[model samples]
Target: MKILIPFYSTYGHVYKMAEAIAEGVEKVEGVNAELRRIEEAIPEETLKEIGAFEAQKDFAHIPECNLDDLKEADGIIIGTPTRFGNIAGQVQNFLDTTGSLWMEGALIGKVGSVFVSTASQHGGQETTIRNLHTTLLHHGMIIVGLPYSFAGQGTIDEISGGSPYGATTIAGSDGSRMPSENELEGARFQGEHVAKIVAKMTV
Candidate 1:
């Protein structure tokens, strides 16, 4: 099965998590995975002035996601950094253009999963993921989440981001932090769970 991962990351944390998730999908035999990013909404001049553009350049090699990619995927995983308890505007804008897909139920019955990164532990990870879930559900996609079967979901010894909602990471206020191995484990589990489910459904 082919799984498409579409995401928007400002400081690379979400990208790292996406890589971990790709690794998990690869672990499952016969699952094909590809990474793509949403279109940038930020103006080039502003992005350069604020340093977010330079950071984006590091990931420029990744292809821009298009509606065709969404239409072609057997399974989809979305990753986005939180913006005030909501999905980033870039992700929102990308989804906004999928009206035709939603109208025809193009994504119906497909396995859809999400992962997120936030600036703080309570930086609206749940809300952001839930919002994405709401959108995917509208398209008639089956939602997949990072279940407690993953150790990171229940760990009391460390700060973590996994929940029944989805996998997550705390990127710190300045967006300087990368996802820890624990958080990446959560992302990996999310990927593997979605891959297995897609496998079963496709078979």
Candidate 2:
């Protein structure tokens, strides 16, 4: 089975979580995951101001995700940094172009999940995830989240960002903070769980 992880990141925090999710997907034998990014709509000047956009080269080679990638995946995971309590504009623009796919129900029955990052603790992480789920539901995709079986989802000891809605990270203002170990683990759990679901559905 194949899982597609399509994410949008400005300061690279979300990108790191995407890689963790892919790592989890690999833990499930026979399931492969690919990481792709939605095209950046941010102006060149604006990206330069974020700084990390140019410094992060780990995923520079990955192609921009398209509608076909969405159609072909047995499961899909989306990640994005929050923008005013919602998903990034670049990610939203990519989905906006998938009207034809929605018309044909190309994603129906496929599993979908979301992850997000924010600048502050209450920086709308939950609302951002919920907003994304609303779109996934419109595509008739089965929504999957990190259940409590992944202990990281319920952690309250160290400061972390994750819940039943999905995995999340706290990216400090000015893009200083990165995802904590627990948050990354949560992302991986979500990936493995989604792949497991796809495996069973296919069986």
Candidate 3:
């Protein structure tokens, strides 16, 4: 079984979470995890002006995902930084190209999950993930989330992000904060949980 993790990150927080999720997916026997990048929509000059060019280079070597990648995978986990309470434009652009898949029902019966990063504790993580679910539903996917069973999500010991909707991390306003260990653990759990579901369904 194959699980494809496609993500977009402006400052690497989402990328870190993606790596952790991939780790979890790989824990399942007979499952393979692949990390992919959503194509950037921002112009090179604009990215440089916004100081994100250099940070993005860290994961630039990861292969860019295409629609075929979505069709071929048994499960998919998406990661993106929240953009104004929703998925980033790059993620939107990538998902928008899946109309053909929807027409052919290519993704129907697949497992779909998402994770996100936001600039603050309440920066719309749940809403962002919920919106991503809306898209997956349109593709007829089986939605999976970071269920409450992940005990770390219920703790108030540290300011962290993890909801029943999905795993998330809070980036500082200036984008300095990375995903904490707790948030990454939630992401891993979600990934493993989704992979297990796909394994059963595919088998």
Candidate 4:
């Protein structure tokens, strides 16, 4: 099984979440996870929006990936840094371009999951996950999320990365907190669970 993990990261917090989720997917035998980034179109006012000094930084530019990677993926897990309780504009923009894929039902029956990073405890992680789910549902994809059996289920009040909705990470207000061991373990378990479901459905 091949799973595509595609996302956009602003502060690199979401990138870490994607790596942990990919680690989980790779744990399953015969499953492979590919990480890809979405490229942003150059804006006419890029320097004005980002400042000339900041535009020179590598992080200032978005990377590119082939859309065929998404088409060939048996499963897809998307991650993004939360923006006002929704996916980042770049990620949303990429999904919006999948209208042709949706028309062809290219993503139908594939397993899909969402992961997110938030700057605050109440920064709308769940809302962002739900919004991601809405896009997957439109493509007739199967959605998977962490179950209550995971070790972190209902255990941590500080950060509940495990959700029935999907996996997530809370980066804290200062962006210092990384995903806990339990959260990483739970994310891996979620990936394995989704892969198994996809295999069974394909059979």
TM-score of each: 0.97, 0.96, 0.98, 0.85
lDDT of 2 by residue, 145-174 (tens): 889898876777888899889999998887
Per-residue lDDT of model 4, residues 83-126, tens digit only:
89999888988999899899899999888998888877679989
The number of residue pairs in model 3 that clash at the backbone is: 0
- Specify the poorest-scoring 10-residue window by lDDT in model 2: 50-59
Report lDDT (CA) for all predictions. 0.90, 0.90, 0.94, 0.77
Residue-wise C-alpha lDDT for candidate 3, range 1-203, written one tens digit per residue: 99999999988999999999999999899999999999988899999999999999999999999999999999999999999999999999999889999999999999999999999999999999999999999999999998899999999999999999989999999998898999999989988998899889988
TM-score of 2: 0.96
- Collision pairs in model 3: none
Minimum summed lDDT over a 10-residue window in model 1 is located at: 50-59
Candidate 3 worst ten-residue window by lDDT: 194-203
Candidate with best lDDT: 3
Candidate 4 or 2, higher TM-score: 2
Off by over 4 Å in 2: none
Model 4 regions lying over 4 Å from their true place? 40-63, 157-160
Which residues of candidate 3, in runs, are more than 4 Å off? none
Q: Provide the lDDT at 63 for model 1.
A: 98
Error of 2 at 143 (Å): 0.4
Query: For model 2, what is the alpha-carbon lDDT of residue 190?
Result: 90
